[model samples]
Target chain A: MVGIDEQDVVARPGGAASPRRVQRVPMGLMIPAAAGLAFLVLPLAGLLIRAPWTTLPRRLTEPGVLTALRLSLQTATTATGVCLVLGVPLAWLLARVEFPGRRLVRALVTVPLVLPPVVGGVALLLAFGRNGLIGRWLDSTFGFTLPFTTAGVVVAEAFVAMPFLVIAVEGALRGADIRYEEAAATLGSDRWTTFIRVTLPLVAPGIAAGALLCWARALGEFGATITFAGNFPGRTQTMPLAVYLALETDLQAAIVLSLILLIVSVAILALLRDRWLTAP
Target chain B: MIEGMRRPGPVVDAHIVVDRGTFRLDIRLRIESGEVVGLLGPNGAGKTTALRALAGLQPLTAGHVTLAGGDVDRPERRTWTPAERRPIGVVFQDYLLFPHLTAQDNVAFGPRRHGVDRRSARQLAADWLERVGLADRARLKPRQLSGGQAQRVALARALAVHPELLLLDEPLAALDARTRLDTRAALHRHLAEHPGASLLVTHDPLDALVLADRLVIVEAGHVVQEGDAATITAQPRTDYVARLVGLNLYRGTADGQTVRVGPDLALAVDDPLHGDAFVAFPPSAVALHSSRPHGSPRNTWPATITGLQRNGDNLRVQLAGPIGVAADVTPAAAANLELAPGQPVWVAVKATQTRAYPADVQPSAMTRDAR
Candidate 1:
């Protein structure tokens, strides 16, 4: 039997009793906690175990692999930038302003988060494809069509990823103390100036966290990009789409691609943990 | 234009009326330049509502606000000035200094917003910090400063804009007792030097007495009393103000030297008045006795001790009878009398110690003439 001293574990700074203390784990809770950890970690462990390690370096250098990886990175970053430009103000309006039907509008903004990605892709295509509602006007007036293009991939990714950014930024805006804005007004700062100077800086951390989440979601997007952009090798194929195509003919290549995505995302998320993840 | 000539009109004159739900606040205020008026009230007495209305943060439901002889808000005329455009500065109760900016930048924020160049704005901020005696701590953030230092920084930030009117809400309420004393003295000096009109809101009587030139006491949503500190202290009309100033107040009808305080209790006050009046004296003036003593004291009443507590070095006993009164006695005297709750005792006060004044004079009418 292993015995632990409660006093040693409960020792706090300044010798004061901490309101929240980590107690010795009971078997009732310990079993489920370990099982939950295993449930999340086992799949990543299996990916590493089944990876074709010997051929990974050569497979990673393949032109198709590099093109897909590069497209995924470029499209995800651009989509995140688009989300930041459009979602931040929406979040601000939702958080700060009072208007009729605001609750309904907020619910509509979050529709993509719960909607099937394939449906969202279909919705985007119906809106922006050639001969589609808005797409026909664009094609007739400016000779522009978004379907089967790189820009379509970015549009689809942003459509699916924007809800994350808006939700995070709006929560940040809500949590910020509004009295500082009042103070700014008393100091002769108008509404726009106050928003740019005081409101933006206060919610910067939330925006950063939201943008990271959005970029990660965009990178993983497959169904929407495939449905809306129509996979062509270099023009529209992203990593997830290439991984899907590779799975039909070459299982090893698919495993290698999946391993790459997993490794890169895990590394990036680990690096960002100290920054946005730990913030209150 | 002569140096000694008085200004023609007040810097701020306003009548503010705000209605919210079932509560309504109506107040009229006028302040000349270089005068600090303290709005003193209890928790839900509309002091903050009046302050916000003056700052243009809240609109008046009726009436108008004129600052420096210019109309700022007039609900009847459909004219209203937003808070940002008004030439006013406010130090909020918590001193909401921008947490992300350093003290210097926070102080410079107002001037920069008013179109001052960055270099000159920084210079102005430095000068204001120096004036507040926090020049050495200008580079520190608000969280790094102590409560007193944060208050001084807030003051500097408000004054850097060079506003024509200044408003403070419970400026010293956030500080510890020791820090409040020091900060209050410093604030008094700055207010004396300020050339603009200032309005301060506080519930503490000490803050009003020590920092303000005049006090407007609000109860519920209206002004119950407004006078200089000496006048208010000497005579408080409402029971609230009486308790605030620590006086035993009673309303009665006076006939010559005798005043009927209750149905059976008539206090012998040394005043010659005939109509309805009020009599007031300090608790220290009341003498407690175990039995009726033969003496030259003119007033005496049988009272039952209801409660007793330590008041400074003496014990204050609350007694209930025909007229409720408080008597302060030394602890030794209390022990000798064997005083306890529900003990019967006799209370007396000399006729010369009590003051009688006419009661029918309304405070609102008095405030207009006093101002």
Candidate 2:
């Protein structure tokens, strides 16, 4: 669509199939782009530079570090699972069904994406915590509370991360061809069968992308996880929280944790992007 | 599967009335088992709207649809069956063979949804693919299949359901000219084999003429003509139908052998018909003369050449006069006569070349009979 070959190679009189197309970046765009890249990469560079590489392996194997890292991975994965189950149906509703308050429902669905993570934690607490709305009934009925537990970490992470999955999946559903559904119906597929057999597979890439984003966001979550679930090392102290806690006593430990989180995210992103999202 | 002889009543019987903004489509249709009716119309004729209303994709504003002896949609009685519940299949214009599925799976989807087990469904799909002459391409996805191959897959998928009623919207319109010829022949075979009723919507006159058992021409949401291909082509009722069939036709009052088609214009026909009548003749019937020469031909008029284009091996000249008409001439004759636009020429037609019939049937009386 950009016609990169036409813009670059064809600009040269009759040079149609040049080995390399010289793409020019205007000074106005180039200067700001370079600055933006530097702004994002500088902190990661600093973390790597300050990392205690000599003791990195030993620190990574430490019980405290391993416990927090495991918790982070587990909570992030579980939260992504939760989002997939709940958010996908919500996305389908927003994309495929027409209702009186659909526009408002869609707007509300995206509220968590912009809401402060700390405020999100407070909202989750009031909704599901002790002596709160549904939490009171849950507490009285089951004697099971969510806050200050490992389960709370997943709940808090899911609450903060679900909007990403919902938005992406909804967009995918909206973009899918509705004519295929009609074809399926004519083939005698009920609405439920159509959704499971036709609609889901059609929007698989979007769901994958949304789940990835949700997982990544949940992995790095700090504000909501700590506020609602509390900073118990083995339960709620995820990588980001661990890094923040380590920063007070040892900068080297914090650098190592940050580097671990970065490596894991970048590796997963690179591998999945190539396998799923990259166009042939 | 639909039975050709055993069925007693029509496979589909419907009167669909749908209103979208100012456009209203009111059509009554009936199709006996094994009958393929081609719904032919110009753009914005509400052909697609009518198809959807019958398929239950869109709700009818009025009237009813009865398919396979069961009521499908009757707004007045509040009786309705959704598309999935109705025993119907639709081959969409683009085929819509699920891009993610193999050709086998695409065909199997219908059977599988209809409650056939997976392995048996796949077997049915293979048989269908073989019947459509795409057995070798069964493993390929829709994107990998050629246009013609995909068309077959769509047809197979629709038929795999064994629907009592089948709806095809512009089934062969997407293919290239060469592919269309073969595909049209194949589609004709398939439609014949399909014992259920079929209604195909198309703007291509050739597709309608060659594929349909009967042609139903609609214009501006109303039926303009309905008959067998030969009958419809021979006696096109409206100017749009006339143009589609490549005939020059006019309506006027008939006095004995001549019909006054326009002010100061009258054409002589072999048949003597009285009162309102229609006169029709092929473009090949008209002969052009550089000057007035009038012994053999009974009708002659001075006309100016408005346009000229190649129609097959002959040159089709559009003439403007009191009654506009098209005249086809050999390229040799066209060249020798110097047939260029704005050139004055004498047009002549033999009385025997034109046909005249009484114009007693009103436009509204012609229902594109497909129920």
Candidate 3:
């Protein structure tokens, strides 16, 4: 019942003495914060500074490099599209509904976010590989094997990236006002109509941001793509796969590939960020 | 009653009965075409629940809801209409305008969903915007509109569908005082023109008196009183309703025009004949005198001021004595008498102005069942 001002001790004690000595500095807070900031930026800075300069154009213009980039864009875009179709509804269920195992369901959705991409790829293979449980039946009944194909690359990327969209969209759905839905209902609109007309528009910004995150994650996916789809030129090979393969033979080529990926991603993100902020 | 209401218009005949935990909502109401009934109640009094049930958002534990002569909800037959299919419109307490859509688009949304073509829907939306006097603001998003303007747009959205029934939930509660007054007058005019059966749920007594043909007062999910404002205000059956109507009410034994209140206090009235009767009057009816008056028509008593609150330009002084009552007096008068909490004063009411009636005016069976 007491007001906000009465509860703030810091605001009440305005006469506290200022630190006058260097020894009074608190390293417990400052040291870890600075170290954490550097730890994240240093690796990115290292990539930019160490990239190859000589023969860079020849490396970039190589048919194999262009093929990998094309494959990467195609698979990542497909993965992002799949995520949008499934993740939005899943996020809605998580944010709005109360069902048995809801908590378990939410936790399970985030497993890919926490699990190593290689482990996720292994799990997918176990579930969908030829001779696997459902995979064997699919192969026998439909001859639709999924592994070692471009489709497999998309599946792996989507698996590793979907959690980003689900988590972000769900948070936004929860934060958005639910009264608007009720209002829509009162205005003679049904649940689905309310969602399409009101809920989706209100949460468009969050969904766009989530989509960008999913796309970026899909674009950079390496371990899952390699483990599930393997490395094949013009088929399953993507930019990350090309970078990894080059690392084995030519570290300089790998650095150049890494730099290309970095610059392209930065450009795309900068262009899309404004659109995301202004979404519906 | 069912067969008689076959006209192509609103004729809502509903007896809504619902039990939420220990609270129960039981009300029988009827609204003919072009009628506006105000459902008035305090918070948690099931006003919203009744409105929701009418809108098919809440299921009734018992009773039936009929709109435009069709059975919307009948628990016995296990029939219920979903909110979407029901030809009813509701204006929510908070105008839930779609934040992304412009005001025109938001108003057009319902019409488009109901199968009106896009261009026509927009045209209808524009027409409704003008009806609510917001034509220039049609292109603005909901966030950009003022609260009153948004509320008007919400009303227009509900009206655009030409629903058989219209429901408004605390329509003015979200507005500032100045906006509320203006909006209330405008809403009154709109409701007057609306041909459908309109149900307005509000806790504000002034809104009920000003805009409704009849008042239905609910408390703790049950209809406590229902009548024209004057009847309910004059003969409130419960203490809650009495307080809302701003009357000091007491029930006791009455011998002729004189009613025995406490052991020592007997209120003298001009009305004759009584036994087990009630006496009711407003705080403004009581007059505070400097001392016990020698007048033959005034029933005076020595009282102590218990509390004081501002009521318009005067101070509403709560007095405690053999017969407790409230009196409104000017601050200057209060200061002249040197009035303060616990200050002794004399209060009186004209014998001719005092009203006394049968205390059994409220049926005990209903009261006991009500509790």
Quickly count the clashes in candidate 3.
2
Query: Which has the better DockQ: candidate 1, or candidate 2?
Result: 2
Please provide, for model 1 over B194-233, each residue's C-alpha lDDT reduced to its tens digit, 9 standing for 90 to 100: 8788999999999999989999899988888888998888
Docking class of 1: medium
lDDT of 2 by residue, B155-258 (tens): 99999989888899999989999999999999999999997899999999999988899888888888778878988888888999999999999999999999
Query: Model 3: per-residue lDDT, tens digit, A237-271?
Result: 99999999999999988898899899978976886
Chain B TM-score, candidate 3?
Answer: 0.91
Candidate number that wins on lDDT, 1 or 3: 1
Question: Stretches of candidate 3 above 4 Å error?
Answer: A1-25, A53-58, A263-280, B1-10, B290-293, B362-371
Q: What lDDT score is found at residue A38 in candidate 3? A: 100
User: Which portions of model 2 show Cα errors greater than 4 Å?
Assistant: A1-26, A272-280, B1-7, B362-371
DockQ of 1: 0.75
Backbone clashes in model 3, listed as residue pairs: B276-B359, B277-B359
TM-score of 1: 0.92
DockQ of all predictions against the true structure, Cα-based: 0.75, 0.78, 0.58
lDDT of 2: 0.91
Q: Give the Cα error of residue A159 in candidate 1, in Å.
A: 1.4
Question: For model 1 chain B, where is the 10-residue window of minimal lDDT?
Answer: B1-10
